[model samples]
Target: MDLLSIKDPRFLKDMNIEQLEKLSEEVRQFLIEKLSVTGGHIGPNLGVVELTIALHKVFTSPRDKIIWDVGHQSYVHKILTGRACEFDTLRQYKGLCGFPKRNESEHDVWETGHSSTSLSAAMGMAISRDLKNEKSYVLPVIGDGALTGGMALEALNHIGHEKKDMIVILNDNEMSIAPNVGALHNVLGQLRTAGKYNWVKDELEYLLKKIPAVGGKLASTAERVKDSLKYLFVSGMFFEELGFTYLGPVDGHNYEDLLENLHYAKKTSGPVLLHVITKKGKGYHPAESDKTGTWHGTGPYKIETGDFVKPKQAPPAWSSLVSETVRKLAREDDRIVAITPAMPVGSKLEGFASEFPDRMFDVGIAEQHATTVAAGIATQNMKPFLAIYSTFLQRAYDQVVHDICRQNLNVFIGIDRAGLVGADGETHQGVFDIAFLRHLPNLVLMMPKDENEGQHMVNTAVNYDDGPIALRFPRGNGYGVKMDEKLIQIPIGTWEVLKEGTDAVILTFGTTIPMCMEAAELLEKQGVSVRVVNARFIKPMDVEMLKSIFAEGLPILTVEEACLQGGFGSGVLEHAEEMGVYGHPIRRMGIPDRFIEHGNVDQLLEEIDLTSKAISEKITAMVPKKKQQRA
Candidate 1:
């Protein structure tokens, strides 16, 4: 059978282990070839090929819920669920999503992208099933790294306490984005090397039987000895103590082992934890050998040599610029420290970690903990720069509002990937940071127009001792702008006028600033002089500058690569209203109140009508014909 024609896993029900193994190989080859062109979570998908096959063979999907924790590893699940033929359009504009989409298939029971959510979602499904008097298994396949997340731990406590009949598959790959860290990771590590406990249990039971036929006290002592053996040999006893019927540290790649343990879990009553260990990036050589997590997710690469097809002479990545700047500042300032929520490589904090190992902390998959930790460090008069992606920051909203903003601590938040992140889609886009952060009092939120300004913003955030300051930088490479020899701190709430004109004023910042500039230049060709202002500061906005711009009575067009509601544009409107400045035709251009899907940055921007041509046309219409003639 053709791999592409494999619409569903119903075909696997009759196939033996040998046939399943062959199918797994075909699936892996398909993923490697498909993902090499489209680019995706290749490492995770590759690792789970066999495990996924085993799972589909045992359990019925759509009926028995299989919730993937982060959903990045759901590629194999997708392939088996009739999405194999749609691989060509994967992550492309208006095509198949990278993450699990509820609308995509009936098999995708729960949508996920952020880590540690599967347990809670599975619990909900279990409860719903129970309330409806339905009989179906609810299994959440969670990674070892994601197990450290506070929410996952919370869910574990609840699920154990509730004693619901559900199977929790702990996918112990020993990694999240980077290698797993902290105490929980250590616990899983101990479990991985503990070997099979069933053999030891059988041996102990036989030895205890040999000493039987001795009455009461002797029988009690034998029972105690059996219990003691569990503590000595079974690492899964930890989960047993949590009120869960713990299974094995099963070999995730072995079909026989997976099937056996899965069968055992099905037979067991109440909550059961099935621990399965597998290697991340299993089959592909480049991905398999990856120690630094570079191959976890990647772009187009050569299939033969396993080398990434490099684009011609790109500018410095935004992450590298911000993180490297932080590292540079940390050299002089002893108080400066860096923290990331499991993304050292993605955040480009590897240099900082290398330079200041003691000062850098990677609090694996715990965004809420990371935010508060930064706050705790700030209380001691030490500066902690919490580098986090914009989407993940949404998880730490309460911590930011209550701990950091309310306390007015001097914590520098480096908001990496601050706008449409492309390929990763709606779940990963950083569009909400501006709207979310701006609303919090005492939190200074800003973005830079270019990498040079980004360095200064980093300096500003570090230097600002008033309250919590956040610097948002977009994903991908910078504009290849010239750098300054000396770092200078720009004043808070200050706007820079990039190009001056009298017809209309274009207020924008960060990635949108380039678009505004280009639009302004194009408008100049059309005999319409447009002023472009870099409204970098989103919160505590440049009020004085805004007042001056409105005083000129020039039609104002505010643009941002963020949501229109409660965003930079809305901020401008609120200020205009507060100052009693009315009758000035103000137009706002930004992301609409809808989730933008996965695609390239250019495609996404164009889809949202955020291109230079769109901006120029809007600005031309906004400016009066009389004003155009004067210019």
Candidate 2:
């Protein structure tokens, strides 16, 4: 079987168990080799090789609608569905997506990057099928960790009440990035140890039948004893009580077990929860031994030794710079506490967690709860640093508005990955945070130009008792700039002037500052004086600086690596309009009003014309020829 040349999973249905086993081995090898060169969610895909094969065997996709929650594990499915040839360019610029894409193949019925969404999507599909009188199955494969999400639980409750004919595959690998926490994870743990329901059912029936002919009282006692067996043997009674017919904690790697349970689930009338137990990073040793979740997703690595390919020496990661700064502040301030929604590893809060074990909270995947909890913590006169990714913060907008902003509590929010996050693409990009957070009352939003500024901002956020303040930082490493010996609290609404000029001003912050500087340098060679201002404070918009610039009558160019609509540029425009300085020639450069796709960061920046070349060209055109000649 040529893995690369393979097309469609229809061929899988005809293959015997031995052939499928061989194919699974080949797939593990293929993923190990390819993903080593082109990095991806290798651990997850490797874990699901057999389960994905079994799924394709048991149900007909496209017609049977297999919706994957947080579709990172769908690489196996993609390969089976004729995408094996696209492995070399995985997660590269304009290459194979890390997650499922509807445009990539018809077999991808639903697209997903976030967790705990598949159940709702599957329910909708099931209802539509019922309405149209269609005969295909609707199966949503969710993970044990995602089951704890508030949305997932709400959908579960609704699906159970509706009792729709859908099969829910609970892929229990005891982890979601980090080891799962909260009450739901404990329930799944108990279910893992509990004996199979079928075995207990048969034994109970046999025991009941052995009872001699007895009176009503004796028969009632026997019936009571039989019913008690359900509680003793079946740990999934929780889901059963919710109206879903629960199936076994089947071995996900075993082909026979997976197929049998899947077939049974397909035949069942109402909703069924088929619990399939799997091992995360089942085949690969380095990924398998990952206790801290470092191997969950990775960059290119050495195949022979599993050593990650290094860039010789690199600056400290932005996440580390922020989290470490928070940890440092937390040592002095007893009120400072850290919280993350099940991303301690990604957020780089392991050190903080270890130091302040009692104060650090990894509240699972419940962003809504995390937000409200921070608000609650803030109400008690304690500072809560809610560290979350920019994209995930979108889920807790209501909480941010109603609970945090309305009350005007002092909550520090560290918005990590607050710009175009390359590789992960549109669904995971952090471009929308500024747009969403800037308009909220009693909230101050800012971004830092470098690691040193980031530290000061973190200090500023933790020490501020005024209202809720957020610091947005981009993905990957910082610029390795020199740090000051003592921390200083930066004044709110203050913007820094990095370069002095007379002809034009380029106002930007964070990752876009370097580009602005480079563009200004290029413009200097052509005799154009371009001023670069780090517009760190997004909301308050350095009004004094704006007035001075407007009085100087310098042409302005606003550059940001965020959405232009209702973003920092929009804020600048609003300020100008209010100040009656609308005559100044102003141009905004940023991500246009479109969802950016997955690609290299530099490539994506170039695509949107946010490069130094584009900025220099725009600024050169804006300034007058006489001004350049005078310089």
lDDT of each: 0.91, 0.92
Model 2 per-residue lDDT tens digits across residues 608-630: 88899999999988999898786
Q: Write the per-residue lDDT of candidate 1 for residues 445-521, one digit (tens) a residue.
A: 99998999999999999999999999999889998999998999999999899999988999999988878899999
Score every model by TM-score. Answer: 0.97, 0.97
Check candidate 2 and list the clashing pairs: none
Q: List residue ranges in candidate 1 displaced over 4 A.
A: 202-216, 629-631
C-alpha RMSD (angstroms) for model 1: 1.5
> After superposition, which runs of candidate 2 have C-alpha atoms over 4 Å from their true positions?
202-226
TM-score of model 1 (CA atoms): 0.97
Q: In terms of TM-score, how similar is model 2 to the real structure?
A: 0.97
Top-lDDT structure, candidate number: 2
